[model samples]
Every structure is written in C-alpha cells, then in structure tokens.
Target: MDARVIILLLFSGVCLTSAGLDKYSFINERKTWFDAQEYCRSRNGDLASARNKEDIILMTDITGWTESWIGLNDLNRETMDLYPNSWRWSTETKSRSGYMNFAPGEPNYANKEEECVDIWTEGTWSDGECSSLLNFVCFSGPSTDKTYHHINLNETWASAKNYCRTYYTDLAMIENEEENQQASSNVTDPAWIGLSRRAWTYSEATNQSFRRWWSYEPDNRSGKQFCASVYKNGFSDMGCTSKLPFLCSDGIARKQSRIKIMIQSNLYLTNQHNKDNMLQQLSASLTRAGQTDFNLSWSTLPQKLDPASLNDDHQ
Candidate 1:
C-alpha cells in the first residue's frame, strides 16, 4: 500500500499602483450628478477635482470651455461641524482667527445654511446666508487708517468678495479690534465681509484649497446647489440633479496581481469548508498587520506528492 500526500497552494499579496495627481477626462454625455458619479466609477474614475487654477484651466481647455460637473460638493455638510474647521477667510494671507467679536448667540449656524459671515452689529459677527444681498466692506494694504472701505453695494457674499478684489486688495480681513471697527464703520445694517466659508469638498477628500470661482458664484441661492460645475469663467455650485456633461478623474492607477505560496499540511486540505476557514483566518491576520488592500484565496486543487517522497517524509 502507498500513502498519498497533498500540498496546499495559497495566493498571497496584492497589486498596487502609486498614482500622481489626478488625470481628468471630459464626458460630453449629459447626466445628473449621481448618474455621472456612477458612470465615472464604472470606468474606474470619479467626477473631476479641479485642484488649482492651472487644473481648472486644463479642464476648461479640455471641455472646450463648457459647463460640466465636477466632484466638489457640499451634500454632506448638514452633518458636519460648523465650527473652526469650516470657517475661512476669503483672503489667502489672512489667519484663521486671532481676535473674536461675535454678537451674543452669534454663529448659531442658523439652520446649518448660514455658512457666510456678516457684521450683524457694530464690530460683531454673525453667520448669514451667502445669497443675502447686503452692503459690504473691502480692505487693502494693511490694518491702517482708511484701509477698510465700506461699499454701499447690495451684493451677495461671493459678489462682494469679487468686487473688493477687483478694486481693492480683497474683502476686509479684520484681524483685530481696530480693523473690525473700521470694517463696520458707518454700517447700520448687516454687511458682507471677507470672512465666509463654503462646505464644499472634493469626492476624493483632497486637502487642496485651490478654487477658481466665477463672480457671485456659489451663492447657494436655492440652498440646494450642493454640487459643483465648471463654466467658461470658473466654477459654481449647481443642483445635483441638473443634467450636464461632466469630467471624470482617474484618482490613482491600480492593477491586479496574484502570488503563490506552498503549504505542506497534514490536515484535510481538500475540504472546501476548511479552505474557507483558512482564508478567513489569513485575511484577519493580514488586516491586523495593517495590510488591508490584499486579498487571500486557495487554489482549486492541491498538488499530489510522489509516493516515494511521501513515504520518506513519513519515515
């Protein structure tokens, strides 16, 4: 009589492809934002993230300067914190915050839609809708006399920012009490200032601050313009259901691979149940080791060991 032996085959490791910056493609077909997202994902991509002015330029050039959907959106903002992380100054040089002068019970974030700030009272701030038309203040040079200029123009926050940038340096960046007082001077009503924030972010959640907004864009006039779309001038918030062509971005390159490992085991390797248990154990070990991207599986059949070899091994 001769004894038989089985050698188990295990597939281990995963395929990885490191990616640089995202590469975008213009899909001329019109689809709603959700449909477009699904289509791009089917093609191993997502809606585009125009990370900077240069990227926006490239995207516009590719789309022939047409209105198209991008991945930036604020759909999930209702559940996000309306605190320090979300608020930002329109001016790039302005610090996040140093001096604080908020009207009592200010920034109540009213209905989670008031992402923009305004001078609710003299030298005090309150959150307001970005779409509200109000007088605004502009700033230039430094926090000196006559640096902050009050403009009696009834415009939205985005429009005010653009108006200030076109004429003065930018919207008023009230860093301290003096600047805040200057920004609020002679203002008897709530006015738009440089301080405002939008909850929009890219699908991939990249931490890039680059944005190229069209004048008065992202006004959130309908309060439902949670999705971002690119136009000839720049980007604007749009309703997600609006049908439009979109840009799909290949986030990172990836590939599939397989590696083999031989396991000499005396256990019943032919049992499908045993193989499944082994795979689960291996997967758990890999996950614990911080290698989550890989998958594990066993080959369909085991290699038969030579009779002589099995006898020698049993000796």
Candidate 2:
C-alpha cells in the first residue's frame, strides 16, 4: 500500500489582495524595539499586528520565543529632546468621545515631515507628509450635513483642512470605527483622514485594538520602557533600546506556496499510514492560518525510488 499528498497555498479575491492586510511571520533577528520596527518595515511589513486572538495565536504560537517586539508603543520618548513636553492631540477639533484609528507601527515620527494622516479605502490608516496632496473627507456641525463629505481634489493636508473649516466644518473628526465607516462611506478611494502628531497627539498608536498583557505589564519601568513585546504567555513593556528578536507581517502583496511529499511504502505499511496522517494535519494548519483559497492535487512519481540509490556509495 502507498499514499502521497500535495498541498498548495494561494491568495485569491479582494480581501487577500488588500495592500494593507496583515500576514504574520516569526523573525529570528535581535534588535531594539525601534530598530526592530525599522527592520520589519525594511524587509517584511511592520512588527506583527495582532488584531485579535487569531492573530495573537499566529504571532505567539512558537513557545519560548518570548520578548519579541511588537508594534504598540508610547511614542513620546523620541521627541522628548526637541519638544520637552508631554503628548497632546494635533488639534482641538476632536469629538467628545475622542476616538482615534492609527495603523500599526504608525505615528512613530519615523519621518520628521509626517504630521498628517491618509486613510486608505480598505480602512487601515497611516501617517502622511503634511505637504502631500490627496482628496479629503469633511463633516459639519449641527447647522449642516453632519455625516461626511468626500471632496475630490488635490491639496495638502493644511489646505484641505482649511477648506473644510471655511465651508462646512473642521476636517472630518472620526471618534471610532463607526465614524470611520461613516467618513469612508463618501470616499471610494484614499483621502486625508484628519489625524497627525503636530503636538504629540497620543501616547500610543497601532492598528490593533486588542491586547494580551503579561502580569504587572506596561510598568513603564525606569521611565523609558515604552515599547511593547510578547512573551510565552502575554505582553510586557520594554525600552526602545532593549534588543530582541521580533515578529512581522506582510501586506504589500499576496503569497503562494507549493509543497510535495512522497511516501516510501516499501519500508512499512505503518510508516506510510503515519505519513498520510501528517499531510492531513498540514492541510488543516494551512487552513487555520487564514489560507482559504488554494489549489491542491497529488501525482505519483514518474518512477519508483531505486533502492540502491538510498546508499551513500551506490554502484
């Protein structure tokens, strides 16, 4: 008796094609928190974004790989020297609820010129250079249409903002995902999303809204441990300089993979049976990891293995 299996991983449809969706991987390189962020973006995506339990399992699955730097952090430390003050919002036009939607590894002040935001059509957000041009969304006060208005025009963040104030109200202020949805309802493409770090807007920023903190976590020890990391069980706070291996995710493009395996039935029926079971498990794992669209098939080798070749010194 003999058995064989083939497995394939593929990306199909709009959800998987999204430019800013997260696909996670474990990195074995060690670097400080900020350094890890740079490394991840330079190579993969940003530090791993665990949007929920499923993502958390994907990032922290391999046990003993603790202290891996993630994307969340207290962003004020970098500018303590230039500003000499605590964090503050970019503008006073915030809603009473004070909702925010920053993308992972964002508002890092990575680019000195990044003091505004651009929300993509897919819903994820990122900081934008203040002078960059894009269409914008706006909302008015009680006097006018208070929902949202997508202005299709090219203008810098400052100009777009001013236009809103002059005509309707301040640029659209999104206090939560609900408002994010409401603002996006008017725009079918990317646009300025009224978010920035003018005066150190918020202390923390990341696309993920979920957290899994370790015991007594986020201690902010020594007044410098601002970045976040994950351990075997949960998360902990660390300084920007603490070097450690990290995790990352991919969003720029879709991924595809092919795997082929052969069964040596001549050895033993038990062995062949075990190999068949292993492939079944592998198929399950690929699906569990959010890989839904794929193509798979199996084919016998054109020829059986030559027994003599198994030896190192074959005649």
Candidate 3:
C-alpha cells in the first residue's frame, strides 16, 4: 500500500507539549564578542551566562578546551570613550546611581591598576586591580527580596562577577544601605562586590551577581583589553576583536511533532520508485492547496489505518 495526502479537513489532539523554556545552548561557531552576542540573541537566548559554578561547569562542558566569549564585558571606554577609570557596577544592579560609600582616599587608582572595587571588612569601598584574588558576593532574586551570599573561593574581580552571575546574581550590587550591611554582615574578610568601573552588561538580564578571578585579570595590561573569555585558569581580558568560540543558551526545550500520513493505496507501494513518486505527488498537491509547509514520506510501520480514526472528533 501507498500513503497519500487526502483533501479533507481533520483536527486531532495528541498530548500537550511545551515549545520552549530557560536553558543553555552551545554554539561552536567562532565570532568576536559583539558578533557572538548578536548570534545568540537572534538564534538562541544569549551568550552563555555562567554566573555560578554550576553554570560555568555546564557551559564549560559545552566548550571543551577552547576559549569562549561570555556575556560580561567592560565596554564603557570602548564604546562611549568615557573616562577609563570611572566606576560602574557589573550590570543588573538594583542600586540607584550617585550613592557611594567610598573609604577616604579610596579608589585612588593606586599604581594605575585599581579599577575594580571591594567592600572592606568595615563595609566601606576601596578600589583595587581587577586581578585581586578576593572573596566575592552574589545577589540573587529581586531588589525587594535582596538575597545575598558570600563566596569563599578566592578569585579576581572579573571571575567573581562571572561566578555570581553564573550561580546567583550579577555580583552583589548592594542596592541600599540595609542591603549593603546585610551583604557584608556575614563576611569574615574583604570580598568583591558587583560594583566595578565600566558599563559592563551580560548578554541578557539576570538576577545572579557572582564573580571569580585568578591572581589579576582584566588589568587592561596592554590598554586594549575589553572583552571577557572563560578559561580553566579563570577569566581574563581580551580585545573584542579577538575571535573565539562562544557559548549560547536557549530559553527552554519543548516537544515538536510532525504530521503522520498513512496511505490505503494498493499499487506497488513497497517499491522505492513508487514511494518516491507518491511523495512527489503529495508535495505538488499540497503546494497547489497552499499547504507549502509540510513534509511527506513513507510510513515506518505496518498498514492498518483509518482517516476517521486519526480525527480527534472520532476519538
């Protein structure tokens, strides 16, 4: 027997299936930071956001040993040409602008490398190199809820930011005095905060604020480092023009189905030539009927079928 598309209207219900949700995708294509972000936004969700250890691990598994672009970037001076040393938070902050608690003579840009800030034990802010291996904080949830956690792992400011975002929030933004106090309250030593100098934003918005680093990263050591890349060694600054394989994530995964066409023809249907001819006829008929978005093929099973039984009304 042969299968064919019948010219009849039918409706059927199988099972409920979701189309999409929050998830990650790994793209093996190599692109610059900006190009990768564009690719992810158009195709998947966004550039991989490994804000915590789990996120990092998941994306790392997708990346293997290759360096890949992530969402975190300090592009203020690159795109806007703003003051190189101006302070900005890691993106996705809950705090309003113009509020600061800098320690006296703090952020002196000492030795010309102190570009990131830290919340000292006294809860006051000080600027240091982005490479400093210090503990960091991650703020999860919304500003109203304001959940914070202190990470004990020593990492540089950039890595700390990535850590918080991958796992929790963006790096603790310290939305207000009370939230700030709450963030530092549980710390036994100085740690990194979400606050840093630059208009850094992830590929997409998220509530996790975590960072990890090696000894010193994102030092702008050559005065050209702007984009961020993940390495087993930790995060480091690279030029946005650098080409590297990047990570991507999807919203979620869902079920997709195809139409099942069953035939009742008594020709030489088992022959490959006959099957191909039937499929071609079905394709032409569908096109003529303005049903251009269908796929026709030979059935993979035995031939006891009914058009009425396929209809939901019959069921």
Best by TM-score: 1
Tens digits of per-residue lDDT, candidate 1, 58-84, equal: 888889988999888877553444434
- The sequence of per-residue lDDT tens digits that candidate 3 reaches over residues 152-225 is 99999989977876786468877567777888887888899977764454556443345655568767767788
lDDT score for candidate 1 against the true structure: 0.69
Q: Model 1, residue 13: what's the lDDT?
A: 33
What is candidate 1's CA lDDT for residue 246? 94
State the displacement of the C-alpha of residue 255, model 1, in Å, after optimal TM-score superposition: 30
Candidates 1 and 2 compared by lDDT, better number: 1
lDDT of each: 0.69, 0.59, 0.65
Backbone clashes under 3 angstroms, per model: 0, 4, 36
TM-score quality measure for candidate 1: 0.41
RMSD per candidate (Å) reads: 21.1, 19.3, 20.5
Q: Which stretches of model 2 miss by more than 4 angstroms?
A: 1-21, 77-206, 251-315
